[model samples]
Target: MKSTEPVCQYELKAARDAMEVIQGKWRIPIVISLTYGTKRFGEIHRDIPDISPKMLSQELKALEENKLITRTLHDSMPVTVEYALTPLGMSLRELLDELRNWGKHFRGEIVGK
Candidate 1:
């Protein structure tokens, strides 16, 4: 794991593909928010501060198109829509957790927190 070398071509392509799918600033946060279970549009916006309605709508559509999350329209009195992670998106949970841990460690090392 400590090899200081470039990744193989296949691994490079795979990492690039993942970066393409989860490229934008809001995508990962959006996915993280959904990890807590399904939530409505407003709830997601509220959970992630500073994301505009338009951007959230656009990202949600992109995530759905990428098959990471599902958008369900519930037939209730007022018609509610909820977003939930598909198995593919849930697959990122461990990776995200690892990233979080690394971020904390890096911050502590660099900032002396």
Candidate 2:
């Protein structure tokens, strides 16, 4: 079978940086949740039921620090905060879609499901 692209030439530092941001039990799921639209902290937590509030806070900070997501505050009777993906983060849609397809293909091959 022919390969799609040349073997990856990713730099160790660059790869590690990428991993550092998404390195968690919930980051990818969080990203997927945000894919639907910008969301408030509680909304994101509700979407990913398994993540603890503390862990979710930590992960959100990491994502913001890495420029993958933006956090905003709204002033009202009750303050509100929302998070949205940056352009760099939105670029992951293609990669994530590819991963879903590959995972489905691999699972079928391995588990006969």
Candidate 3:
């Protein structure tokens, strides 16, 4: 049985806000990469094959702005930067795992594999 109550605007707006933050082909992938461990710019670019440097830079900025990831700078002979997921970002682990499980199930069902 389903409740007949209409969905509230607050609920819809919250969902939309979540979607807007992660909205982009690269944002999720970028977050996925950071899920493993901290990585430098090149490593992230290589991890997600075919993403141009410019795009990766842009997405990293967005994720950082959203407080999902932290960018750290190391000062050596030359500066190095690394990215790691924030606590907020790590909060998505369970969600990502669910997506992975569902994707595998869907693939098996649809592809008959």
Candidate 4:
């Protein structure tokens, strides 16, 4: 007999987990910034001036924990750390791009400005 489920429970769980990782005010912006290339903490903070250091740190930690990004530390004179998107995170670029196109279409239809 066929189970006839739209999606497996594990697939649903994966979807929910992905959402949780990216579901935050600053998370998407942070991810988008890293999509281009690696960035240092100060660079990210400067790019997002509205986000407090504490909040940005929290989001970076969460993203790192979820394997969406990787943090590398260099043993230079003062020690340097940079963040780059993981393969999983980079996979979101296409999806986000599609969303951006959809948003533009919707805005044009509704706002018509």
Best-fitting candidate, scored by lDDT? 1
Work out the TM-score per prediction.
Answer: 0.90, 0.82, 0.86, 0.80
The candidate with the higher lDDT, 2 or 4, is 4
> What's the residue-level lDDT of 48 in candidate 2?
92
Native-referenced Cα lDDT, model 1:
0.94
Which wins on TM-score, candidate 1 or candidate 3?
1
Which numbered prediction scores highest in TM-score against the true structure? Answer: 1
Candidate 1 error regions (>4 Å):
1-7
Q: What is the per-residue lDDT of model 4 for residues 5-88, given as tens digits with 9 covering 90 to 100?
A: 587889899989767777978998899889778999999988889999999999999999988899999999899999999999
Candidate 2 lDDT over residue span 24-93, tens digit each = 6788898989999999999999999988899999999988988889999999769999999999889889
Off by over 4 Å in 2: 1-17
Error of 4 at 66 (Å): 0.6
lDDT for each candidate structure: 0.94, 0.88, 0.91, 0.90
Candidate 3 residue lDDT tens string, 1-113: 97899889999999899789879788888999999899999999888988989989899999999999999999976899999999999998887788789999999999995
Candidates sorted on lDDT, descending: 1, 3, 4, 2
Q: RMSD per prediction, one decimal?
A: 2.8, 3.9, 2.2, 4.5
* Candidate 1: Cα lDDT at 67: 97
> TM-score of predicted model 4?
0.80
All candidates in order of TM-score, best leading: 1, 3, 2, 4
lDDT of 4 at 93: 91
